[model samples]
Target: MKCITRSLSCLILATVASVAVACSGADGADGAMGLPGADGEAGVKGDPGAAGENGDKGDPGTAAATEGTLTGTVTDAVLKDPLADVTVTVKDSGGATLGTPVKTGADGKFSVKAPVGTVVLKLTKTYYTDSADIMVGVIAGTTVSIAATMSEAATGAPTVTLAWTGDDFGYGKTATLTATASSPTGSTLTYAWANNTATKIGSVAAGTDPKTATATLPTLADATKLRTEGGVETQYVSAYKLPDRLEVLSIVPDTRGAVSVGVTVTDGRGQKATASASLNAASIQTGLRNVALGQRVYLNSGHDGTNAWTLTTKPAGSTATGRGGICSPPPRGGEYVRGGRESRRDSRGRSSAT
Candidate 1:
């Protein structure tokens, strides 16, 4: 039995030595650490332990992402109706573009994401004035709602239609000019008349009608030229001078024959419209309306034994209103001179001509 026990003990000892070799070194000195193998399956859970006193407060952990949202609606300034297809943008304090511009949807409402801080919200559309810059405080984790109103820009180019009565313009004749202006907004209009060249003839200011102006045909510069060169009336009265005071009409190449009249119209908004027309002057009566009802026309001259022929009105033409026809000198004195030309100045300084 003792022999049997010793053999069993030996077997046990051998098994124990194999386990020790696998677990540790026999030299007793610690060996270099080996790479840790994968953790074994988690051990069975343990029961809760007694709670301990709090240690120390640790530093705060980094915060999660801080973001903001903007929700805004755009409307028309005048009509107060929602406006679509507008571009909404957010800008930093430095005026740098924050992200892509957000376009409004069909509802004229838009929402965009941005970093948390102070930002400017802007709304814009084609042919519209931008809304005033809006400063918004973009608090982290919050959405801001904004209302924007945009105004339509002043884009109306005014147009005008001008008309006038009395095509014929003779010395002492008058015509009326009218201007009608139209605009998209039905805005007020202003009227201005300028010559074709914009120079020489200068411009004329219309009457109070803002649309109506009266033009009085003035007489020729020289009375005698009426009989010679019937055309070539070139000079016009200065625009600054009063139309009422103007009596001398110049027949320039422009007015020498049938002509086109031109005028310009302007609106209160500073838009301009121009037009042109073919116009004919009235038949110019030879005699001045200045003569008395029945005054005889052009009779006397400084006759140095006479072979010189002087311009005299025919019997029927002797009146200031009569047709322009040449005849022999008036049989008697008491004749008068009128119209653009000077008749025989018999009384010198006392002699007056129209």
Candidate 2:
């Protein structure tokens, strides 16, 4: 029995040692779990660290855009009063209207903003005669001022009357021609003298006062030629100067069965008027006959004779008489004698031909 007891004790001791080794292996397995606990604390929070330095300055942002303006005024021409509600337009030199129309303010001021370039400005109104144009340069952030003056529209057609100081003129003589003109409203008077060549001398100031101009009677060389030679009547002496006076005989007949005539019968610087009848046909014929008798007739000789004349007898055997004469002298002596010899005999037979 003692031997059996001792064997049992030895078996127990071996069992215990084996158990202790197993327990050690179990603890080794639990060591990985202890590492998980340490990791938990480490994840709980990181240690606080030093602050970082400021980051490099960011790149500059894109630059902002810039901007501009145009400004101006409108006024009346004569009164210089501010004009409101006038349409102001901007344009280019090419005449194209640009942007929008701006109406003037109560103070007649206007302004506009545009890009940098050359621009044309125009101001217009219905009551104004016409529009006006202005040139300007548009720049960024700049205000351009364009001023304009408007003129009043014309109401009606202006009347113009012309009168001369003297109607009768001598060849190659210069006369101070005083032209008196009148108009209801002030008129811009223009002077013109009509001939074969129409010529405009000049224009005078706008007013009711008369305007004067001086023109010289052209020389014969300067006179307008009307006839084609062949002993034709080259020119008619419409104005004449007597020994002591000047006269303008009308080309038409008067109510007194005589030619209407105007005779300035006074001497130099004197005033005179006459209402007597002009030369009758018979008197004209008589005067023509006397002139044919070779009486010397003095005329303004300054003309180059472009308007001069000399009388010549009719060609022999020519049926031409008064109306048919190829070439005939001007009527003289203020008498009209018909039927050559018969009229002459009648004049000599009667004491008074009238």
Candidate 3:
């Protein structure tokens, strides 16, 4: 019995030892857990960059801007200074207004801006006479200056008188009529004279009071006849009468080849007298013939007997001959002798004896 008990105890001890050894082997084989993986390395920060430089400046821009002008002054006749407060206006060639009204300054100066064209500058002042038709030109980008003078206004009635100083009776002769006038206002005078009836000659400006005008008379186209009481056969060559002025004695031609011009002279008191005289034609014809021939000629009984006689050579096959009166024999030429008588008369009826 004692031996069995000892053997049971040894067996239990061996089993215990075996269990302890197995527990020891399991612990050694499995490694301890790595300390929770070291937290991921903190993320590295990005490097700071260098700063950039500024850019360059830009270029300049363009400008904007009108065309041109006309400047001038308005003054009076004396030109002492400019006329102030005068209304100055500019008009185109068609007389259309270009701009607004501009008044003259204290210095009598005014200006206007207009487009390119033909223009007229007009000036007006109170109670003063204005000028007519002052023309100018305005071009692009150009300026023009003009100076104007104004005249004084006129006042009352205009009186006019005319005087004629020329041969009123002659073929192709011109008669001149001059007129003088006196008044406070300006006047325009027109004069007319005729032979048988009234006819208009011409008109002219007599200007501001105390002025003169002139006109040349035209020639008459037809012949006139007259008779005198001295038993003389007189012919009227030409006649002229003033319709507006005065009545004069009748003029006549004398028996001699001369003009008997008559005039009725009135004294300061208005008393009138009749006067007549002979105007010799010899001197006038001699002067006219000398001018025509460019040389001197003989003046006999108021006739240019020297150069008036021209010997014309007849053309071949021509039958020209004297029709009436005395036919002197042809001298040294085969041409026929021709002769005719010429007669002239003044305003009076008279004839030259044959």
Candidate 4:
């Protein structure tokens, strides 16, 4: 019996050892990974940080004034009275209009703003002549004042028209200058004539009729030449060596030039209107010389016995002597006794043929 118990105990112990060995085996491969969990909720936000310090101050700015002012007055030229409601249109040098037009006040005063440059003012109004292209200058940030004038309209003034009788009139021809003038009130018009030339080539005379005048165009014998400072006729010599009694010197040439006839017609009211006409006067005769004062001239050798000639301011001096036959030598040299007739001194200090 004791031997059978011992065998059973050994078998039990062996089975237990086998069970422990299976339990202590090496680690097996890891199992598959599980799915991830969901995310958590966010927390409350914190307050914002404080602002940073300010930067340094900047530099000062510059002024801006790119315009100026213009003020002026408009007045009537004849009456010297202030003109109201005058339209002032400003323009640049290139005729470009600047800004809107300004009207004058009752005191003829006006003010306007303009750019920094030159500008022109064009003034206009009813019953008055239009005064245009008046120049003015403006400066930046400054005011410029000026005064302007305009003439009265010619509504009631006399109107005159002038014309010549013939276009064939020339140097040696007589020109009939006729002026047709009329006043609004039909007043008798008295005409005054003038020769508008540096040299007075002919005589200007008013006709017996009030509207008619005559200008005897210069002939070769009538035109006289004189020296001028700059071809201008401003010097006048004394006719009788008296103060303030001067006469114009002649300066007619032997070439092409124009002479104008101006006529002023005065109405009964003394309001005068003027009209002028230009006539071209040219000498056809060539080689003719002026024999007047300060002129060196010679007489033609082809003179007939019936010809009478008067010499003035001979080449010798300012005085002249009249001779019948031929020109004698000047008094500085002895006179030439011509025609074999005796020559004797007359009572008037003149040489005559005996």
Candidate 5:
């Protein structure tokens, strides 16, 4: 009890002193505040905490990363099966290659940077023609998918055949030509029918467009005819028309030859093919050009001969002398003397005897 009383007395004395100091601060008169003290130094930095566990691997990146993506599958044209190992190359309109060519995987899937504007996609593979040349429009940052196709590579040169409407050909005559362009070896080709002689040989394969062309048959006429036309006064010879010179006005049995037909084909991949054939041309003639029925023994027949190959003499008009185109020239070894008389050529090569 005495000790407790002593502790209480001391606590009481401390409380009394605090109360007296508080009173003095409240009652204090106008005293100027002291200047602010200098700032103390900053505390030292603490050590860093231990690192946290690493995060899970980020989500797998997208299949393609570019301004635009072009993804597609390659397929076989005939088999209709997905094709692998096909190289897909892209080129700009100017023919400039865009980027590294992407190859189709086993799944026939491929992804690449899709070029903008008009662009071409070329697909190529072994033992196959690159028939997957596609033109595409790429939007910025857009993804496009496509299904490309391939054609089996041609094994041999292309085969072609040329046929005509008739067995013969003549000037001023129109004949239909069956210019068959074939791919016996399984090649792609286009048929161009132009200038009458040359035409494309097969249905257009992939990578080519359906081109429109004109098939015009060529007219036949010898340039020599123009020089000789003025001198001829015959009805058939004078009836020829202007520009008619090119027209085969008539089919003379003497004029006969062959017509050549050519054709051009393209593989659509910058490769070209050509073929040619010669057709034995003839005219439709039922009768002979310059022929006549004469007496079996007419030495002096009053007939203007057409041909000068034969000799017709009427005993040289009894004087054994005749002058004409055929007889005037006579024989190379002087005049012919049947009975010690001279024979001359008629207007034609033949000697007409009067």
Candidate 6:
């Protein structure tokens, strides 16, 4: 029995030893891919996350501006002192108000803001003459400085009257111009004359009286007749009217169309007055003058009879000639003439008549 038990134990030990050796051996190579398994159950959906908190508030930002500043002073022109209690009206170049009107301080200084461009300041005060339009340019981000002067109201400014001795004056002729002055204050008066209509004037000499002067009229071309219809001719001429201010009238006679004379008189207290008058300019060469209503007159054809006749038509490349009337001269060589009608051929074989 003992022998049999020993054999059984030996067998068991051998089996155990074999199992341990197999477990401690190196790993074997991987086998071929296996068939895919069935899909498993789906997972549950997750809850949404919470939104982040709002950020902190930022600091305020500054805005850029496109405005500029203007400063100026108002002064009494004659007294050379600052003017107070004067109301200033600011206007754009087009005469539109810019802002609320500003007034001058006791020191005569003023300051205000305006859009970038030209601005005009008009000042008004009691007992003072209205100031002329003061213009100044304003720039962005900069200041413009100005000093203005205002004239005082005149109690009795010198009054002057101007007149031409004769309205009918021929072109390039001399005429007498007279000016009368009267000062309520008995202030002495001085005269300054100007030919406002003509581009250039002739010799101006003082006449016997201080207010009288003689001026050689400027020569002008004959008045142009635009058209003559039904015995009424339309002529181009110049004419001008007087103005409150002594505006210097300077323009071409042919363009503006009339002759006018101006005179300015000043008194002892530096007060000035002005007067203007129109002078009728007649055409001497054409024998043309202004006349009353329904006046009988002959029309000048502007032909001197010598070089004024023209041939309306003629045969090309042909020469012709003829004796002209008392004014038309004889035709040149290489010309054809027939019954006082003449045709002259030029170097280019063209013919023209006059």
For all predicted structures, in order, the TM-scores are 0.36, 0.28, 0.26, 0.30, 0.28, 0.32
Candidate 5 — number of clashing residue pairs?
23
Residue 261 of model 1, lDDT score? 46
lDDT tens readout by residue for model 1, 111-189: 9988898898878777577888899988888899988887666665567777876554543445676767676645466
Top candidate, metric TM-score: 1
RMSD of each: 19.3, 17.8, 22.2, 22.7, 18.1, 28.5
Candidate 3 Cα errors over 4 Å, as ranges: 1-67, 155-354
- Write down the TM-score for model 3: 0.26
**Residues 240-326, candidate 6, lDDT per residue (tens digit)?**
221112123333333332356678898765789998765544421113334332211122232222223433333454333211111
In order, candidate lDDTs are 0.55, 0.43, 0.44, 0.61, 0.49, 0.59
Per-residue lDDT of 1-354 in model 4, one digit per residue for the tens? Answer: 999999999999999999897787678899989888888789889899899999999898977777788899998785577888999988899989899989999999999888888998899887567996888888999999989998755654688999876542544667787888887745577788898655666667888986888877664343323224456322221010111111232333322334567899886545689998766443221233332232222232222122344543434442434342223224343222223233334457686553
Candidate topping lDDT: 4
Per-residue error (Å), model 4, residue 337: 40
TM-score winner between 3 and 6, please give it: 6
The regions of model 1 sitting more than 4 angstroms off are: 1-65, 105-107, 154-354
lDDT of 4: 0.61
Worst 10 residues of 6 by lDDT: 321-330
Candidate 2 per-residue lDDT, tens place, 119-184, comes to 777787664655756777777666666667876554312333333344323334444433333322
With candidate 5 superimposed using the best TM-score fit, by how many Å does residue 56's alpha carbon deviate from the native? 21
lDDT order, best first, reads: 4, 6, 1, 5, 3, 2
Give per-candidate clash totals: 13, 31, 5, 0, 23, 13
Per-residue lDDT, model 3, residue 197, is: 18
What's model 6's TM-score? Answer: 0.32
Cα lDDT tens digits, model 3, 1-354, are 999999999999999999887775434566777777667887889898888898898787754224358888887664345778888887878889877979999998988787676778788876467768678877677888888887645432234444555332332233333334443422233332222112222222222332222222222222222334267533233233212111222333331122333333332222233333332221122111212211111112222111123324533544332211111222232433222233434347565422
